[model samples]
Target: MANSPQPPLDALYQEALATFDTLLSQARGEGDPEPTAMTLASVEGARVSARIVLLKGVDARGFRFFTNYRSSKGEQLAAHPQAALCFHWKTLRNGVQVRVEGRVATLEAAESDEYFATRPRASQIGAWASAQSQTLADRAEFEARIDEFERRFECVPVPRPPHWGGFVLAPDRIEFWYGADFRLHERQCYERDADGAWSRRMLYP
Candidate 1:
């Protein structure tokens, strides 16, 4: 059978956005506590690392998440601005997977501050107390830091740490996969061109 026609770049992006919204809603309706969680992969030289991070936001611009600027992933991103993200929704009866390859950039101070303000008070304090990806002498040392920050910020809003902020992954390529019977999955892959136009094609499972 012949393949289906692909939509134009802008239209295809809109379709992808709609699909994402549907999948996210479905995931939540199915009782997934963290629907926005995704696997983020970063690399440094030959070393690669992957971790789960909650998606803070997504828009026409890109996907955004926050982390410690001095952490391992932060340093790696500084050296190599490209990274990959994977979202697997297993809560639904029919699983869905989304993959993105993108270039990362730090958000502006104001943007970071705005997002930080929305975080829970404890999380905001933790961001200041924990030196992410750093060695701690002991559990007590970490707890002491948290206590110190808690006391220091008492009766005041915990300010966003200077090293804690948001990063955006502006995707150049994205692939959506839907599971099927007999291992014959459906794949739609989109790639952005030099002129910043997106083109999509279907791929075999």
Candidate 2:
């Protein structure tokens, strides 16, 4: 079934994704820098951590990002296999906030390799040099590791780290919120079904 024609994405899903694209574009036009930045929240047991991560890609399947497999967030995702993302574009007319809840899974090795190849040489080096989310004795030790990797990869292409790759979140629910005057905001929620269909509804603000 290689290269076989695949069925189209669910119509409602496509429409909702297109709306996100339009809003992202509008945020760009409104001069909001870093439109793709989203707050990525992951949990480990009863502990939760939230940090900002840039959205690398998005499609009907879901959102994509890359990180060290051994990092705190990555380990959290490994343990829970679920996460949430929040995107707020403050520069848009009034403002817009989008929240996503989803299950996470590792991306294919080939896809990870393709994206890794496009990274800058320095960043590629960092990927190997960093022991992400691990305690360090000092800053000097980290810089020394970077220097070591740089020398090791000199005159050669840096390969993607085995412990580093990509993850995709297949969203089960997506919510869009718009700011309005007098606190009468607009909220739209879209929930996906097991059969890949979507149901959408408006929520009271």
Candidate 3:
């Protein structure tokens, strides 16, 4: 099929971002918990893994989320650096979803630190306590570590772990799906060309 008539590149790019933010705001207005939650999928060798991760930020650069760099997903991202994200707002009528596919990059340390500083004190401690994606023998042992960090940073501020930070998925493709009657849904996809221009097209439901 012929390509959809293109809009000015910059406006189209901003339109996609604006639409995402609007959907997100509507979800929150509907009283949904974790409106920023998204399914993050990464790969390891011949295996694929997916898990729910909170969306920490998003912009033209792509979606951002934080995790322990030493975790399994982290290692996989380090090896692959390509991932997909799906944001499904079930609270929306019949549910709407946005899909993003992109290459990932670890954010600068300063950016990570800035976000870490805003987290709750307990979470800050947990960052230093939990060995994310690591095998745990028991709950008590993990609690013990948490207690240990609590006391260690009792008076001092808990700093972000060196192994914990943010990663941004710079999308080359993003699709939005709006559920409709009789399963005849509406799908719009915006793709970024090699020259960094964006073109949007509709996909058959």
Best by TM-score: 2
Each prediction's TM-score versus the true structure: 0.92, 0.95, 0.93
Off by over 4 Å in 3: 1-9
Instruction: Give a tens-digit lDDT track for model 2, residues 120-189.
Output: 9999999999999999999999999999999999999999999999999999899999999898999999
Candidate 1 per-residue lDDT, tens place, 12-67, comes to: 66676677778888999998888999999999999899999999888877889999
Q: Which stretches of candidate 2 lie over 4 Å from their true place?
A: 1-5
Worst 10 residues of 3 by lDDT: 5-14
What are the per-residue Cα lDDT tens digits for candidate 3 across 1-205? 9999865547778889999999999999998888999999999999999999999988867899999999999999999999999999989988899999989999999999999999999999988988998999999999999999999898998889999999999988989999988999999999989988889999999
TM-score order of candidates, top first: 2, 3, 1
For each candidate, the alpha-carbon lDDT, in order, equals: 0.90, 0.93, 0.93
Score candidate 3 by lDDT: 0.93
lDDT of 2 at 39: 96
Model 1 scores worst on lDDT over the 10 consecutive residues at: 6-15
Candidate 1 vs 3: which has more TM-score = 3
Q: Model 3, 177: alpha-carbon shift in Å?
A: 0.3
